[model samples]
Target: MMTLEEFKEKNYGKRGNTERDELEAGYENFKIGALIHDTRLEMGMTRHNLQKK
Candidate 1:
């Protein structure tokens, strides 16, 4: 089995610094978008309502 560091480097580049940064940034946005999307659904919000907010 590979170590965690090895896996990260293999998938995310050397030490995963660069790719990890990109992944983190994208994930943060994704999380925010998901939260907003879920909240909108719960509130029965339409696209227009979301736009107006």
Candidate 2:
């Protein structure tokens, strides 16, 4: 898990700081969602099953 501070430092660029931060945040969330999806598949669970639980 990356803290916001770490992300900020790693993503800092010459311009578009705000846009880059937002993009990084979105990418991080997407990564987390992908991990969750992969874990469910590994456990032989469908999205429907996860939603019902």
Candidate 3:
């Protein structure tokens, strides 16, 4: 298997545009999860407390 450097070099080409583009497409769910997690922390809420609003 290629090292991460080699893999990134192969898939991301010179400027990392391909991998960055792919990551951009998948970033929304992560953003939402982080927002929810941060809000829960701010509100002192547990995962159990936040279920199904």
Candidate 4:
């Protein structure tokens, strides 16, 4: 099986390629969103509650 880095390179191009950069940025955003969602859940907060605050 190919390594994760090898898979990424094969699919998204090299680290410096435009598609790879965009993919990296999108992944970062997804991670941040997941963190926020998890933290909110841990604090017993819903999306509606945050919107009103």
What RMSD does model 3 have? Answer: 4.9
Model 2 gets an lDDT of 0.83
lDDT of each: 0.84, 0.83, 0.77, 0.94
- Clash count for each candidate, listed in order shown: 0, 0, 0, 0
How high is each candidate's TM-score? 0.70, 0.68, 0.54, 0.90
TM-score of 1: 0.70
Which is better, 2 or 3, measured by lDDT? 2
lDDT of 1 by residue, 13-42 (tens): 773488777876897999999998999999
Select the stronger candidate by lDDT from 2 and 4: 4
Ranking by TM-score: 4, 1, 2, 3
Q: What residue pairs clash in candidate 4, if any at all?
A: none
The parts of candidate 2 lying over 4 Å away from their true place are 1-16
Score residue 26 of candidate 2 by CA lDDT.
91
Q: After superposition, how far is residue 53 of candidate 1 from its true place, in Å?
A: 2.2
Among these predicted structures, which one has the highest lDDT? Answer: 4
- For candidate 4, report its TM-score: 0.90
C-alpha RMSD values across all candidates: 3.1, 6.0, 4.9, 0.9
lDDT of 2 by residue, 1-53 (tens): 99886766677742368877677789899999999999999999999999999
